[model samples]
Target chain A: MTIEALGQVNVTESPTAGSRSVDCFEKLEQIGEGTYGQVYMAKEIETGEVVALKKIRMDNEREGFPITAIREIKILKKLHHENVIKLKEIVTSDGPEKDEQGRPGKSSIHGNKYKGGIYMVFEYMDHDLTGLADRPGMRFTVPQIKCYMRQLLTGLHYCHVNQVLHRDIKGSNLLIDNEGNVKLADFGLARSFSNDQNANLTNRVITLWYRPPELLLGTTKYGPAVDMWSVGCIFAELLQGKPIFPGKDEPEQLNKIYELCGAPDEVNWPGVSKIPYYNKFKPTRQMKRRLREVFRHFDRHALELLEKMLTLDPAQRITAKDALDAEYFWTDPLPCDPKSLPKYESSHEFQTKKKRQQRQNEEMAKRQKMQHPRLPPIQQPGQHAQMRSGPNQTIHSQPQVAAGPTHHYGKPRGRGAPYGSNNMSGGGPRGSGSSGGGYGVGAPNYPQQGGPYGGSTAGRGSNMMGGNRNQQQYGWQQ
Target chain B: MAANFWTSSHYKHLLDQEDVDMVNPLDKEKGITLEDFKLIKMHMANYILKLAQQVKVRQRVVATAVTYMRRVYTKKSMTEYDPRLVAPTCLYLASKAEESTVQARLLVFYIKKLYADDKYRYEIKDILEMEMKVLEALNYYLVVYHPYRSLSPLLQDAGLNDLNMTQLTWGLVNDTYKMDLILVHPPHLIALACIYIASVLREKDTTAWFEELRVDMNVVKNISMEILDFYESNRMFTEERINAALQKLTLRP
Candidate 1:
């Protein structure tokens, strides 16, 4: 969709009854909950312009903004790509986000007047990529897939060149506007790459299902190529109507990949044996199956490109730029124009209900645990502290608290930022050859030909993958 | 920070007249130039240090307070907000942003006990209110990249690190910040010459050390000149100038 179509979401002027009348966005029902806050649809009080208001809930003023929220805000504030979401204004949220002065948060960056509930005013988006793909009447032709592939790549390439990696590159993370434009949305995992030559410090959390093999195998220090691999998975899913690799876990996931691409012998992918978990998994000889076997309905060219993208070695995987450049995108029939792509604003009641239920469930669970059963005793603050690796790769393994999925914020942070240099296993993609032989975080170099517990076969695939360091993304958010 | 003229907030607000300049000291009836405030700001860096240091806050927080003091001056003349009120307010906001919370009572107690000044009467609570205003004025772009982070390395790269060079370099950084060296010269140059001067003062005589180095000699010269002029103008070894600026500034109650 053209960037101009962002306004389609606010076609009807409805402001929530609670909104100040001066704002005049006739409130519609709630849209999706924002990544870290509440969201509602409203029309411009003056020009009748419609927009989405996201009220950010930063629990503690002393602790400051959530890092994920900060990451999203800082990136969104500066990014102006056609395929990116735009922040119109940052109003402090009204309901519960007021500060000691009782001022609604005008903006997260700005204090006081915009305090209480920090509101992020965004240009309206009609639907998300998941919804567009799931539209009951929608059917994607090969050409259309190519078109999306191109747009997705264009956006990803833009992100990469700007040193920002949209690590969570999945269908749901891509928002479709009223026109057919698909803009990249969530940036919680995005980070600026160093201006220096190192590229391995960035790739930690692309979603599983769409995650690259290097990530699945455990190469934390990988680069933009991991994102490219996801684009490949998403591209295939766009054509297949389901996840290309729906592995129950990382091992199964790798088996699914090997079934199509065949076992790694270091010929196709050079650094197989050197990976940290290389000795763990034994890739069984299941007579490699073809992509056609897995996705028999896809066109030959689509299968071919999928094969290139789904390559185990990220270094050899087809790039978003290259995929956009492929014959599959350009030949036989051209993809439909972005504007002509189908548009349907499905009722968001289900998503809204799910979010509300999740929040309720979390709160209830918290209360119940507190009131009844012997709760996990609240340990002192340092109980959860894991030793982090220091500057010299001297393993500290600082237990990192799991990053939030619950928008529960902590104290506004102060002086000490966690040291950027801390890395458990060189912080590279776990098993991909970059594993820390420096610290022996990997399994022994000798490949184990059997299961982790005795000879209970799942054969080679089970050994090397998920044997240890099960910290990979596995794309298991679901 | 590097000379990010195109990108720094300083460049964005330098000549613009959109903001409320609380310290309209330029005497609008007499009509003054932004250049005048800019220079005075350079001078005020010394003043802020004396005050901030008196309260025992981190130099980082002090620098932020000083930068806000400078930023506020860009739009408003110095005469608008009493610099005394503005200074403490900037310090308060800087403390919050820097994650160093000083209790208002303790803050007021220190201020009142330190100088015993009857003018600019303020309790800790009033300082907190002014902090919000300063935060609003600066727009919370608080990821300040100071020259200090870049200076030490610059001094070392100049082949200046010798016995006790690190200590002298730090002292130079601490003392240089008392003036507008930050406003005019980049950080590394100041770090280098301070090391040079320390070498000279110690009779280590490393004059030849600079001859072979390649850099903007003017920026280096500019920084040292600032330090020298500041030292000559103020008795930094004592708190005389701070006491003077405080008394002459006619602070608000």
Candidate 2:
């Protein structure tokens, strides 16, 4: 819709004098939830244009509006590119007196009733990278992967050039519309940086799986190389059909990086030992670099670019601009046009995970009937599995699954079964509890434990991952 | 856009002098003249600075907060937005947007501490509520380009990076917030105007430097004149006059 139409909608539907009310649009469904609040798919009442309405969570905020929301809105306003999510406008609603659960919100700190709600309106997109990649029997052609990677690099290049560090690049933050265009989303952790590199930024950012080695090593002084490391991780995930590194916590996460990218020493990364966490989490065993060996099947040029992106040294990490000029994008079977890729029904990580859970429950029910012919069908699917497996056993089974790299692509080996079985006994509660802090915090109401790939599989699709990591420490806890 | 001045929201939404100077109909109906409106905004800007000092935020955050307040007044009335509430709310929102992040409770504490009058004191709810209105009035275009970002580079380019001259030029850019120069002019032009003023004051020979830069000298001269006019007019703006102008505002219940 045009800007003039938006203005008219504001004037006609505004109940108050100052700003456009949320009455201008109709909320369709709760598509995703983030660290701040719920994200809804809404349609503008006047133009019938679909948009994403991200509620700015304010009910429990003693600090007024959330700082993350403010940063997201401010950064999104400054960014305008075909490859970046568009923040259309901000609309207000009167008296979010009732919280999302339809209960009266906790009394405001000042003992006054909750007054207003803010929703950041953004252009809608169909799929996120994690959701698309997790689709059963879905495999991206080489050209298609190139297309998404190129768009991601271009958008990232724009952000870096604009002096803004996205700080939270992951598969799910890459939103793809029906026409196959990928735009960067979720700038809540984003901040503008200067070329001087003197400022001390928070080292706790990016998802655990995608966080660069420097950030994991507790380096506060960083630049665009941090994002480039994430882009490298994403490129490898796209080619390998799964996450390259899925660590459960900080020490394990750093260990996983050492296993794959090799250990960072003074020779490869000068000043590596000077980082705050170097002595604490230092690897005991020397590990060899295995990017080429692990991803040998990948195209040679793609491997070359990944190697540069996954370099142990942050100083040697390839930039988005330089990565775009990499030969992988220019060689045979080049990156296809975004419009040429095929489209599918709207698939968000939340919806797909729900569908997978439901399907798994049905399959478990069928197995229960076949195994116990005389017993009545268990009413609570989550409880029956727990009753059989026992909680401790179920919990033990998960770490093994998480530790190994089980390639689930061509082999249809009981996808989601291990995770579905742990639903009540182990996975469900742990998943919900982990959402409280740290990098890769799952979205509210979604489980963080995924099928045999740690939390990086089905549950990693929401843009809410990689939330406020301030509560998480980088070094070994004493 | 944060890096590029020409393509920023600040550039796209640069208001004409007439647009920036127009008094809101609501304020005009409340018997607030054009001069009264400008005086109230100037007073609120100072109020924001004082509050920001109490909150211990950077001057950049204070400048951004003042810019937000000014942008709100251009599209809204002080009567509807409540200058007492909007001023602190702008600082609150700008602190978060600029990544400094002062707590709302801290702001409420200082507001109650700074102002004893019932009309000036506001609760957390009032400031939080006014923050939403200000964000809406701004259309969520929160990124602001300031002359401060351009001042140092321009000073270096003009070979005028001496301590006294640099501080004076920086102070000049800070004072430009008291006028409508931010809304009516690009930041670099404003920085150039500050440099021009500082060069004249410090007796620095930068005429050759400015001419070589190949910019519209007339616009720079006009901005310089406007800054001079603001200083001349506000020289006698004491506490009593600020109170009289603010008291004239018909605030919302």
Candidate 3:
């Protein structure tokens, strides 16, 4: 039942007014990370209820409380829905200060000085839509997709009815549990909007991929239709294995959208040309709305709903209420009950690992560019030089073999060899030396040191040895 | 949720007269009578209004702050923490809750200006320290639904949008914050009582509108009498009289 029905007739006095503190919970393993802080899996010590604890990072925030957190807490405190993540309460851990060995250290001296150890307690969920979709062998059936979409719309309807905008609704922001209950989470960006102040809202919201065209073209006066556009994208993504339109940047994102949904014009989107970025870049002529052609497997009812949701005009877009009342939901093979959906361990760990690996690879490539300046730029097959010619050049690109006096000379390893063998030798001193030289101080030292061992066979060998050492040091650095 | 007061926290957490007394039992031991409490609250509400003005916030924010202060006192006793401190802290929290967002420094500065006398003055840290206590006392139910929200819609429905009557009704609604009417009664009834009082003062005929509302006429009559009692006390007890009553009561910070 709903809180309203109970609130009306019953005079059930609340047992207590304030939130119970963190002593009621015991911290567990880290589950996920949010934009501002880390989320951990925790357990209610007394009730044995599993919960998600989001630690609010309060480093250097001289302002008493972050407005983002305050807004989120205030909004979440009032919101209660099965499909919306319930914020149980704000609990403070203010733990005893610990030494490096994890023993409690100095309880009275300075332990209580640190203030921000507060955590937002929420109902624990096993999976998010992104993690579910990205699982290696997982494929959502039509009924399952329908079930998830219904829940999404229901949650959105509740928020919109309550005058709140879930400004950042995307696949990842939609969390799910083992029972397949999809809930809207991460309300850090959500805000309660009033009708009188709709025009002055910020446009820089929602993920770029799921952002609506109106927001992209900078319309602060937009409404619930903005969230509807994201719903359409999520729906399309659910039908297809991949995102329907995965644009790399803002301009390209808009282009990718126009290519699929067809270009907006006066007839389709009145006053479309008036948006600030409309004339800056011209998209090709309409491809005639390929949503039907792209998702030919979708039934007629589903396609009709998708078309209404992806409507170019904000005025024409389907609202969450209308979407909930769509004929598609009432058709054959109706949405599966949330509790009946198949259960699986969340694969969020694998997704996080994949992203971390991708990031490490990019970092290694950057370090390679900085270390091997003498090595000619190896361009990929179809790439142009201008693509790699950005302003982020490392100043440590120049070759320098300085500080020979301080160098504990070791056997020279083969040039361009792997880093492990190089580290076995005395490459540490050379690594530090060249890094110092790369900053220009070692450049002058190289010439001054080159004089002491010059004009001899040993000196020439030392030069080659120094060059090899530099390469080995750069390799070891990676 | 702001538009739906019935389902909001205000209705769900409505307290009776006994419940309010149970929350603050210590006030009875301190010899603070119910009349003296009303006068103290009215003065503090004025102080909150002045502080909100210095920060240039809307009346909605001030009203929310006053409601928060009143709710806090319902759970805490005046002798435990000075109203002088809790009053400004409520405004500080309410400003943020209502989205007006006055900076802590600005709030403290304005508060210092409002209470220039040493007996009532406070530092910025004092207000900040009292904020958490006030929040805890309120049980984090920051959302407050005031009768002012009902005043506009009810007036429009009644076709009684006369300027003088509206202004009088609004002021009377503001004064209701000093009474336990917010704690014990629903916002619409309080609004209806304000309208009834204003109608009687202006000699305007709103009996048909009241009858059409279908609300309990007895409840409306009771709420109006409560406000009239405050007005009677306001005329009878001057500031000196209220101060003498306050002196008899023991208070602590």
Candidate 4:
């Protein structure tokens, strides 16, 4: 029956009882800014508990609620584990407080009546894995890396068992409290996957360096194996103190992966060639598996487990549960208890250091740009040499050029190219095709002649390139 | 925890019947009997289900919406918030939570078209305004585990995988949502109870399969009785009876 008529159902305005209002919380300071919004350190006046208040950016969000916020909230609500970051509660405040003290502020753009500013309250963490790792002269002990990995795997295992795929598992996303406990955070890209619901997930997830081969080849129907690949990358990065595959672009990313692990054939990954983007690019040459040689210091057991986790075929990759049960975790150099790890009196020390380094790099780039207004900012020494050897030849030979007389000498360090000589004259496709195949395929092959612009490489989805390897957002209460 | 019902928020936060009843101790003051309250809730569930179906959302969305409405009343009395407003709000939020994600404007359109009357018309703003209250009352615990997730597997394991048997068992599980069984029992046990009830209705002997499963049959029996009791008691209640009770309940507010 069509129960159609007209009667105004007057909903009684209940007195606000349990809304943790702005008056209840005293804002402390702005800690960090995430992709969605800025996070602030706040203290609950009643309980006096310090929390990271992540303001959900609703300014231009024409869509009712940001999908990432909704996904994170729904996932976090169901998850209750020690290693998983807790979402204490969602609280609403009067839109846009003027000061950090959160005093009775002026009317915001949404006006005084607008109470739609949603803030997610999270337990404050001190150090993120990225900040800790990026700390100058801060080298992680084998046991310390082990402890972090163990916690990461344990938290990841819990998420997987609950059918959630973290999708993003970089160092910065892993938060460490003062107790040295590491908890997985930033589930903005995460979602629950089920076999019955074969949803085609977006491939543009997980920062490029940590992205899996299956994802690089555009496999949309991936599972937890995608996350395992990232864990392997993090494990390797922790050990080596540098990203194993630091590709400049998508093709270069694939090339770097193939250079170290050897190119995947049909036998290795049954449908390797059938992936949507598979035929578009091919690793220049066959290379021997050299993870063992590259990580020469790692124990055999660790290498064995790493190999399994970094398997070219996602179908054959080790799961978080299997990786945890590996001999490496159980063997010599037992994982240090989280509490035993050394603590930094100032947790923000690393954050400040990272910011300073980034600032210096920016200043250096700006100074160099001013020196040669016509020249593109020189990224590599080799690029500078390429510029000098051009028509401006010999006429404007500057002091910097004289200091590095053999600037061409820098070509020997062409990354991922075992045989660097192939990038030069007379170095045919054969010349560099086997130094795990040289930069000739990626760089010089493009006839722009002056070498590909440095900015293009740096700007090519670097967030996707995510060499932010250092500036990972960490919300530390201290 | 979403996968493991024993450790899920559903188990930890869901209240028992007594506590749920305590939330609205003023029901008698509003001149509605406990039985009349049950009928009103049933009608509310039907209303949510109808709205959800019109939007072409999955069954899980409808179940979550109904559960949200029930949870809202477990803390606040019906007099505090009208069910007519809360029902649509729950459905709108559930659609987003379940990832079907219907537009608020579309929901308002369908809700007004279906439920609007001279005595009870709503605007899009009303639905949006009520949405926040529903979220607050739910305490933002949006994830809900349903028997259907576990029921399909149990049905297959019991060798009752035929379309007819599957549909019948699935229908039984949906009906169980009407009671507090979902809140009190693990989803697997609820699935088994529904399967048991479905088997009896079909006159199919699944005793051998049920024995294979090492579950507490006592719990299953209690669950079955709860569903049976609901059916027996509500058999005599009609739309007119529920409407009369709802008129009194809504009159005071």
True contacts kept of each: 0.00, 0.22, 0.10, 0.10
- The digit string of per-residue lDDT tens for model 4 on A1-478 reads 0011100010112323545665567888655543455666789889999877877755443334545566788788666778999988788875555544756555443232333467888888877776555454466888888889999999998888777898778776788877889898877767888855377666766766778988898877888999999999989777655455655567777777876677888988898998998888775556656656666567788789898988999989999999999998998899999899888643332243335335434544565557642332232223212221111111121211111100100111112222111112222112222212222222222212112221123211123523221122111100
Lowest summed lDDT window (length 10), candidate 1 chain B: B13-22
lDDT of 3 by residue, B80-160 (tens): 778878888888888777777776778878776776656467766566556656656765666666678779888888888
lDDT values for all models? 0.52, 0.70, 0.65, 0.65
**Which CAPRI quality tier does the interface of model 4 achieve?**
incorrect
- Model 1 lDDT tens row, B38-132: 34455556555666676677888787677677655544445655566677777666665454544455556766755566765676545644554
Models ranked on lDDT? 2, 4, 3, 1
lDDT of 3 by residue, A1-478 (tens): 3433322221223645555677788878666643355667889999999998876644423434445566677778767788899888777645553533878744422122324355788988887776566554467888899999999999998888767888777776788888888888877657777656444666666666678888788777777888999999889777655455544346765776775677888888999889777887556554455656656567788889999998888889999999999998999879998889989875443243344234434544666768852332233232211111111122233212211111100111222211111111211212323223211221232212212111111210111122332232222211
Best by DockQ: 2
List the candidate numbers ranked by DockQ, top first.
Answer: 2, 3, 4, 1
In terms of TM-score, the best-performing candidate is 2
Candidate 3 residue A345 Cα shift, in angstroms, is 0.6
lDDT of 4: 0.65
Residues A378-416 of candidate 1: C-alpha lDDT, one tens digit per residue: 222221111111111212334222221211111111111
TM-score ranking, high to low: 2, 4, 3, 1
Model number with the top lDDT: 2
